[model samples]
Target: MNLFTDIRALVIDSLTALQSEGALPEGLDFANVTVEPPRDAAHGDMATNAAMVLAKPAKMKPRDIAEALAAKLLQDLRIEVAEVAGPGFLNMRLAPDLWRGVVGAALEKGRDFGRSSMGQGRKVNVEFVSANPTGPLHVGHTRGAVFGDALAALLDFAGHDVTREYYINDGGAQVDVLARSVFERYREACGLTPDIAEGLYPGNYLVPVGQALKDKVGDSLLDKGEQFWLEEVREFATEKMMDMIRADLASLGVEMDVFFSEKSLYGSGRIEAALEELDAKGLIYEGVLPPPKGKPDEDWEPREQTLFKSTDHGDDVDRPVKKSDGGWTYFAPDIAYHYDKVQRGFDELIDVFGADHGGYVKRMKAAVSALSDGKVPLDIKLCQLVRLFRDGQPFKMSKRAGNFVTLREVVDLVGPDVTRFVMLTRKNDAPLDFDFAKVLEQSKDNPVFYVQYASARIHSVLRKARDAGIAVDDATLKAADLSLLAHEAEMAVVKKLAEWPRLVEIAARTNEPHRVAFYLYELAGEFHALWNRGNDLPELRFLQEGDSSATQAKIALIRSVSIVISAGLGILGVTPAEEMR
Candidate 1:
């Protein structure tokens, strides 16, 4: 039902006909031949570079090839006009019936209209928001969570078996800090003045974790040394922190299919198995890494260590697997995690990380490449920082998170839908400004509001039509005589609607869910444009007084617009509004 795909297939069929007629070479490659909307709409409805791309290979003039192609394409009823533009670019205008048919297709498909098989059921593992289980998630993690979740949804819409995953950083020094922080809370719960030291977590959220610890053991570790309580407290505190994180994610409508833990990798021989896989390929070695480029860590020492031969797979240098003290480096488990994903038989992998972790991108890709022997592709999307603003001034602080703005705080102020949409209004690698005032504003400047308002406006039209006794449902709309929708403005909306399935595949293939946001905004813009025109032109309106046939056609068109809008928002994890509150 994708109009663009249907048209492109027509173009390919015509080209094959041209080949059969001896106008083109017997074995001309049409891979580069593309049919898309012309940059300047004034030129035509759709443009193709078929003639231009084949001219050089076929040893023919561009205009000569375009002229023959245009003549052949015009034979199809779907194409009304096919003409050659500058340098033999063939611009073709489709018939009004074709655009009208797209509306019928949308009404028939509903929210599933744009769903595609671009991914071909390939298994994909997307690991994102793998924050340390030391504390609750903060604003920094929110962007990653939203981006990753949206990406998984987009791929799912594009037909991938996507697994939403979170890799817990529990094996790091951050969890050790969590152990000490909880010990203070445990003492405070026991009626003892707790030492809230400088290096500890002082958030009120952990106060309950401390209380829970007292209830579990009745202050058995009261006035005890770190040796006796550290291990017991660390495990208890990590569980509580993870619970808080899960609740925070639920508040934002994000749920992970897998929560792979780094600590689990420690004692379970998973890390050993991953390294062994690498070792079997001779990618593991005992070597000393050269002094790192740029300013080195103060603790950087020249010592022989176990290293992964990542340089063989495009890394700048080999990276340490185990530090000099025999403890695994942070990179070790990450490699193992990717190895596990590859072994799980995913055809593709994507990692979402903060901008500060840019250096890890190359090494992680190298590790996945070595692990998969380049059989699978890995893409890492680094989300830039989000700067929150209130009243044009930078907003900061989190009473619960101690210093950073927690994700729960952002979701509390603005519901999960607003938070998620605003986070995606910008590219993943670009800085985003989350203005509290602007986002909630009902004006068109707010993209979330703009998109939701369009959906709401559709319901408004439906209600108006229903009160007048005009039966309104997708099944009726699809069966309506859509050819009655012959207005130029109505056709423009149909053209925009035709872009959805193509847009979904593009966004999924690029692993950029932000593209979906941008596309939805643009689609909503066109819808609003047509809705506004109805005020000046009564015949252009969805409801035509005393003309049931025309009204049905118009309703089918606008109803299709609503259908595509809902599907686009669904991929973005935003609720399509029926009416703005």
Candidate 2:
């Protein structure tokens, strides 16, 4: 149960009773009232803005409303201390038994302890890791993969119907470049000195693709011109690259529910259908855009282009849907793709793009808004670059990719768990540094290690308790007398555990999965603090020397910590360490 939500409901019920009794106005809006953790823990367990938000509407002084509300709240046994803090803010201290019950609830719920129904089963399409089908995914795409996967998992835990998808960039000119590059490798496979052109992709990862092409066609297409092999080779090479990409994502434990192809939008009537819908809405027009923001207008000449009235929604300027040559611009396919998602009946759409695509955000949002007639909302999250370091210096580029570190290279070096946890340690839009030495270190400085170590500690305690002939199974511990867990240090950990469900809703609502990582780190810290306190205070020790009852209470508390940690790590796509070597 969410204590914060429970208390908020209590406050709402009290306010409604006040209105029924004619103590307050009958039609006042209470939507703005909120119950949240007190900014300062010492102030109280929870705080509410009911009085401050309702004062003017009720035509009553803030203090008077707060005093009346405090009286109503104090009647509940859960709230031990209800007092007015600043102006009209009400802070309530919950009874210790209420905090102890959180541990029982966590142990009973296990990994489902923090699961929330915040999304209410709304359908959400999370499209991420849409890296071009050009070569192996790089470290930049790795961040998006982990972030998007974790976000999908987070939303699912928060009760959203999430679909993880990947969009292939096979329809673009880059795939043509890839075809030419693969053809060079194919020439080398045929015992010819292949020319490694400067503009072509020079990564050696395509050497296998070249050899595979030879195995398939047996030199049938060799010595052929662009017209004869370009289309076939482009299709063949894109499939190979996508196979390699799927393998890369699998190595990191990511799977896509859909792999949309940009080529599918072309040659089909989908692009026309999307644009026609916009045209019917009077959003499509023919116009020449002003010179690009920072470019010189002297070299810019006006040309009539098919434009979308993106500015009418929220964009800085209208965007071109088709170029002056009447060919579809890059933005056209993207608009059609989103329109397809809307037609598929997604309540919400989220695209995880690299930071370099930040300029496309506003126009994309505007297009989706116009297409959905404001019925659906689209959120675009940009993942910034990742800098790699090893041995206190910049890590060398991949020998395979030849320019950037591949996702497989990072995963092979430190394993996928470390790669993912470290990547999410920073916000999606913030640049992250992956220090090879620091991340694998055993110290608390490594958040991944620290959090996993907390789970390891719990397992160790359970083993020690079992060895002492004490029952430590979840069912037994859950039925333990939690009232015996009254130490201040023990209560601190339980309080943090109580915030798990609340934290889940907040993180999911903000569309930020990094908050889960941050919260897990903080929870681990509190747990470790309690464990260390046991070293000095014999009474705080989880395993009492002779008292089985006291030991059971402490075990219940720590076991609950492990349950929440596992739940948090599960959302992050990380497996909790049962034992750390």
Candidate 3:
């Protein structure tokens, strides 16, 4: 049901005909030919560059090729007008019935209307929001979580077997700090004044982890030294922090298929095994890395260390796997983690990190490339910072998170749907300003609200038609007299609907789910434009008074709009509004 694809196929067939007639060279490459919407609506519904691309290769003038191709395309019933516009661009106007079929196709397919098979069932692993299990997730983690989750959904819709994953940083020093902080709470549970030290976590969220520890083991570990209780409390507190993080994600409708533990990679011989694989490939060596560029490192004396030959795989320089003191560097475990993923047979890997981790991207990619031998591609998306505003003023930090606004704070203020939608309104690498005042406003400036309102308006129209005894169910509307939908405004909406499948594939291929949000906004604008036109042109309304045939045809159009909107919102993990308040 992809009209553009269908039209492009026709163009290819016509070019083959030209080859058969010897009007063009035998076996001319047609891969560069493309059929898409014209830059200006006045040009035509679809434009093709077949003539332009083939002109140089065929040793013919572009206009001659375009005119010949246009004549052949005009023979098809689906194409009404095919004309040469610019030097070689062939713009086409499709038959109204062809555009009308889009509405019927949407009804028949429902939410699966725009789903694509471009991914061809490839397995993709998306890891995001690997926030340290030290406290509740903050605003920065929220953006990553939302972006990652949406990307997974988009890939799923585009026919990829997507595994949503989280890498737990509990194996790091941060967990030790969490244990010390919880130990303070454990002491507080023992009716003593706990010292909230400067280098320790000061958030009250750990008070419950403290209470849980007290409940599980009572005051037994209260007076114990750091060695006696550090391991036991660190394990207990990290589990609590992960539980809190899971709850936070649930509030925003994000669920991970796998929660990989950094600690699990340790003490399991996994790190050594991963490095051994690299060592077998001669990628591991003892060497002294040159001083890093762009900054002075006073302590940057040359020290021989175990390193990964990352430069061979496109890194700026070889990276140290083991520090001079022989402890594993932070990069070692990450290498092992990706190697484990490759061993699991995922065809692709995607990591969502905060923008601050930009410098780590190249080395991580190099490691994955070496491990997978460039068989599996890795994409790291960096989410820039989010600045919160309320009443045109900077939002203050949360008392729970201490120095940052918690994800719960934002979700609590505007609920999950708004939070997810607003977070994705901006590109992942672009700074986003989350203004409570603007996002909550019921206006077109708010993309989430505008898109949701369009869905709500469709539901409202369907309800009215049903109450008036006009059958508006999908089955009925799909089988309705769609030929009666001849209005120019109605055709414009159908054209927009026709672009959904194409848009889905583009967004999925680029690994950008924000494109879905942007497309939904544009589709909503088209729908709203059509709806506003109905006020001035009585015949343009969805429900024509006393004309059941006309009413069904128009209802079919807008109903299709809702179908696509719901699918788009579904990919974004946002609930399509049934009614607006």
The best candidate in terms of TM-score: 2
Summarize candidate 2's per-residue lDDT along 176-263 as a digit string, tens digits. 9999999999998989888888899999999999999999998988877889999988999999999999999999999999999999
lDDT (CA) for every model shown?
A: 0.90, 0.93, 0.93
lDDT of 3 by residue, 66-160 (tens): 99999999999999999998798899999999988999899999999988888999999999999999999999999999999999999999999
True-structure lDDT of candidate 1: 0.90
Task: Please write out the lDDT profile of model 1 over residues 464-501, one tens digit for every residue.
Answer: 99999998887788789888877778878888888888
Candidate 1 error regions (>4 Å): 295-300
Q: In model 3, what lDDT does residue 33 have?
A: 94
**Candidate with more favorable, higher TM-score: 1 or 3:** 3
